[model samples]
Target: MMTKKHLALSALLVAVLATTAVQFFPKTIQPAGITPPATAYRHSEETSSVEKPCSNEHPEWREAQMIEGVDIAPAPACEPDNPYEVATSVKGTNNVSMMTLMQTDLAQDALVMGEDVDKDGDPDEIHIKLEVVELNGSSPDGEFLINTYPIAPGIQPGLWVYAPKSRGMALKNFNSMVAIPMLRAPSPTIRVEQGDKVFITLENTHYLPHTIHLHGVDHAFHNSKGEDNDGTEEHAVFPGKSHTYEIQPRHAGTMLYHCHVQTAQHFMMGLHGIFVVEENHPNNWVQTFNVGAGQVRHPSVGVKNTYSQEYDLIYQSIDKKLSQIIQNATDPRLVAQRMSRDYNMTESFENYFLLNGHSFPYTLRDGIIAVNDNENIKLRIANVQRSAVAIHFHGHKATITAYDGVDQPEASRITRDVFDIAPAQRIDLQLSTQNNGVNSYGPGLWMFHDHVATGTTSDGMEPGGNMAILAYKPLLDENGMPTMHDDLLNEVFSKDYYAKKQALWAQGDFKHLLGDAGLIVPPYWQIILFGLAAGLLIGLALVFTLKRKQA
Candidate 1:
């Protein structure tokens, strides 16, 4: 039998051994299949595509690609000899004949001509219809989403946006008997002449309630009936309900219109758009709505006076945690509760950034500024993200013409390479491709992107968010691809690039120097040797102590 002191020492050693063994095995904090099932779906609809007609039979119908609910038909071939003569329907003219816009509306849409009051050839009364649309949403059966708006490659965040009333399927190039509404993010840019009577009818088709708050626009606080005229949650239009707002803005400037219903949540869900008011000019039929900000197809006569091209640049950010909440539940109530109450905005961080409803590579498809030498381009930029963005332009320094739609004083107009835009702030920049050292470096492919480190990343991937290029016409190929590009399009264009699976610079010449050769994992022999060595040291110390005690 062991002595009492030996027994006590053995007990202590056993206690220590037990504690060490416990650390090797850990209990599961959360098990799989723990998420609760959805209760019910708000709406569901079956959507299917139709066959395309043969070009021989239907020569008029051009080949189309569906992008952000817009039909992207290829533009006509560039004729260097004759710059005026061209063929294309992608020019955003609504009713104006292609014959009329052979020269102008190549990148932008034409103003929707309305009945000119006072025989002035300009519209004084404007009526617009908007419907709430749910995009990339899930149903109880999870099959209702037809035209999904994917921000980044392989990512579709559930969104609710206000869209103009139009016939046909929501997505273009999709042939379907079902007349789905074309709902898209950064809702259609609404334009009206300054001091014109404007009526905006909001048709709430989604399950949740919404309201249109004319942000920074002139509107009455209350209507004649003492009802809330300013769009707010208190005066929200319920599901299947409709409300009309009347406003005649006194100023000519760029403004915002967004949902005021639980603004912290609903606004971020993509219920917002640019609202522009042009100075009243006779016969200046303005392009009333620019769905999906890019080129103003039918630019107002006023816009044509100063700038050759105008772009509405709306930048936004999304927190995946908040967007994923919509996918977690089918019940509209649960989604609303989770988004409006359960989710804490302060604790969340933005994971995605968008320019004109698309991330970097996709942004290049439409967001690029194609310019000629000495062309005056107007960029109406709005920062709707939570944080400020330092918009940096490579090879160009633009002059700030306006802020939040107000014209900057001539003396105060500043030319800068990077513009610091805060949340909900609008900045108008006059970009002149003059080749002057002060204005532009030269005719080449240059990048203009957000300088805020995180704003440039999509889910932490570089070259991924709100990044667009300013390409000189000579540098662009017939297909609009940059002729002289540093990057391999085939590599960056792949989904693997955004997915983080493909290693950066793996295909470069310096791959051997920078490639990620996987680090060696601890070998079984090494682990065993380490354990044995530690045990031997412990045993030796214990034996020495026991011998000393015994002596």
Candidate 2:
């Protein structure tokens, strides 16, 4: 009996699904770190597989084990390698498996802001040295200085992973700071406790060129004769180098480490990170290596305390007009103007979209966006950016159980909000407002953009670039940190508390409290003008209830 065109098509499909479940009701990757180790190192039979997201591939590497699908039912005369078993129709093209990761550079916040080396109580294995001088950062002054040392002196552009529950420590001499890493995105984090034993080390000291590809580690490559065993074009570490790469990640999840070179302008000139391997075990301690900041779910409550709760987002993006139109071409003519004058392979967005770098007073250094109950708890997300990232969490719904680092499928537990991710993609979202998620519309002060809509908005301004939120009353303080604390951390430690919030927000009288003004009115056309005024007030309440039932 509801026929005002089905009550204006059910109130315009519940107001366009309550504005896409009211902003995709929140949101949320693949690829575990990588895997491989050493005895004297450098030993590869080579491998590479694809059709094996969870099964069948070549030289074996979807993380050398733990695949749960593909009707696997063959090889088993008591073999001994069971990453979780599942390999039946073993196909051809030698599935995927490649490894050779070595990049280390930590100095901005130093892995979760914790680094207690030699003081006799954990946190110091981050020994750094990097060097790329001259661009204003300085250090050249003598015709390319040929030998200031560290031409990649074993490049470990910062990686101090630790996950103990089954063993996976990848520390290579943990240490940090020397200048010239530049990070900014959502970089700086290193929590662990899920099958630890992930040691890593690549002390290059920098000069230029770098290398660390564990993009989605699996180890083994080009074997059976040919060459190249995932050492990224055969291990690059120029400008004053060193090398130490190992992986024991028997697959536990959420991973990435950038710089595969020219790799989209070296991961957009800030390398990348967020290679967490934490799952907590039956009692384990000893984690200390800082640079981008994050680590210490436990280290004696982190020396005294620093992170009882946290969040790092870092989903980067900034075409700054394509890095100023590829800084006037010239990398072989910008690869021949990207293969003959930019042949639009999807133009790729830009004009700025950063979060941990600056975009809303540098997101106020991570704070301001609240609702109480601690902004609903746990959310790590990281895209690093190139393209593809659709988060949108207004009324909340994020339950993602991990991806790109694996873990999810305990019967798909949790309704999981929405997510799109692509480049580097790393998700850990557990976000909630609780019971059907709601702090009075996910309560207090929420938001967590991108779900497209021009990445929430930036170069076009309405909500200018890579937005932020979900902060609610005390996003973390008492030393646990973060509560709108950006300006690239006092502009990389020049400090002045962001020069007094830009001299009182440039005198704009608090301009909407600069929290990114989240609510949805950002170039999204106000949720299509509130779903066309909720479809003309449900078609005028079904034509006045059909003229009072035809009087």
Candidate 3:
């Protein structure tokens, strides 16, 4: 009874109604392999506000209060006789007991693998457990907290680390600002003896997947029974999961370990650490790992005999735009979408440079390389930064001992003040502090910084980035902090200066020259103006040529 036109119109209306109904009652089905939304590892509420100051009065700052309380010296090694025994209450066992104690004891950052089941003096098997944690790092001035290096007072997302538990007082009870569990750079350095069976277990507590690829170190591609233990992208450990790597390093040298899953992103997110395999020397229970950065207490056989003191110097740069992706979203689903689908790495640029973990002034607070006159110090320097860096040690020359964990021949060992270190490159230098004409200019507060001009600034602010001093013992204060001239500590070097709130050059001060003005005109406008002028000139020339031809 309906006309063809009416019938068609009715059909269209029905289709539209059906589509609207479908929108109201959407399908519950999800695409295959899509991960469900998980809780964020670090919530916004967990981080401290930037405006609030970190409490120095907290018990953790007690050791740093006194000038001499800052212990720059290395913690003594645990005796081989009872390596697992931390205190009278804490005793490590072989079977699950050791693992249980490590988790319960706040003091245990690393588990001592000294179980000699064969009654041999040396440990037959070593087990280490590490957890990936999320935390906020306080800015140097205690003005704000961020997930990344707190060079500027902003909420930058970053990764934190938990070292292998040691048998001692729990870390929670340890009163030190550096020991506080928080996000930082340069993960704990894992030290092992050559020939000792080492088992490193990665406990993925973060929201994302991760794997530990032993970079440069000797490791097996596959473990017994054909399991994928290489810590590659194919064998990523998901959140709440665990993976153990079995490594019996044949050679002893400086090596690297980092998260291999989405390597470019994860590694830049601060998931890498130093791995050292020392020579098999008698009773050589090397300090299992150097968590964060400071003095290396347990030196390797090579370092202990050759140098009076050793320091692990890790250089890294941060691209804040890329790092902020993790902090932009609170939900795991949103984070995955932003990092994998939305973020573009091609446009990323490094804004903050770091030494050890902190920026310039902060680096001097803890990263001072204090040395006595004529003392030989070992500097195990690694360039974890993406860009190339030339480390110029002021007033001294360093003798190169090893390159990329390989010992250089004595004849080929180069002595240079400026060492060009590429990305992921490791250089072990013997810094001789002798006041000789050739070796060193003499004892003084020598500045050791990146030769790259931009490397000295934080977010384009001068005197902010990876600059620190090689202070002589006399220049160091009682707390092991370097004492700089008052001129250096003036308002110019203050946090507000780097934050760009304060002016570098005061008004009416002609002492400093103000640079030339940048281009005020828009680039497109200039291009259009140039095109118009060219067109007018060409028209005039053509008219002149035509008139001449006609005449």
Predicted structure with the largest TM-score when compared to the true one: 1
Better of 1 and 2 by lDDT: 1
lDDT tens per residue, model 1, 1-551 = 34687656665665565455444433221111011222132222221111111112222222233322333333211211111111222212343354534333232222233355667865576666778877766556543443456565544666777776544345544442122323456676777888877777787877888999998888888755576779988888999988888888899999898999888777777888888888888876666666677666556778778887788899998877777676677788898789888999879788889888878666665577778899898889988888899999999999999898899899999999999999888988999999889799998889999999997888877778898888887786645556654345544555445655455765556468766542223234545555555555666677777788878
- Top candidate, metric lDDT: 1
Question: What are the models' TM-scores?
Answer: 0.74, 0.27, 0.71
lDDT of each: 0.67, 0.40, 0.62
> How many residue pairs collide in each prediction?
11, 119, 15
lDDT order of candidates, best first? 1, 3, 2
Write down the RMSD of all candidates, one decimal each: 9.4, 23.6, 14.7
Candidate 3 on 509-547: residue-level lDDT in tens? Answer: 422564222212223444545555555555555557657
Task: Identify the runs in model 2 with alpha carbons over 4 angstroms from their true place.
Answer: 1-195, 199-208, 211-236, 239-242, 246-270, 280-313, 319-350, 354-378, 381-393, 396-430, 433-447, 450-455, 461-551
Residue 108 lDDT (model 1): 23
Where does candidate 1 have its weakest 10-residue lDDT segment?
46-55
With candidate 1 superimposed using the best TM-score fit, by how many Å does residue 89's alpha carbon deviate from the native?
14
Tens-digit lDDT track for model 2 on 414-502? 54446877877777665655544342353434556776777755444434355555544445443222445443333212111111212
Give the better candidate number (2 or 3) by lDDT.
3
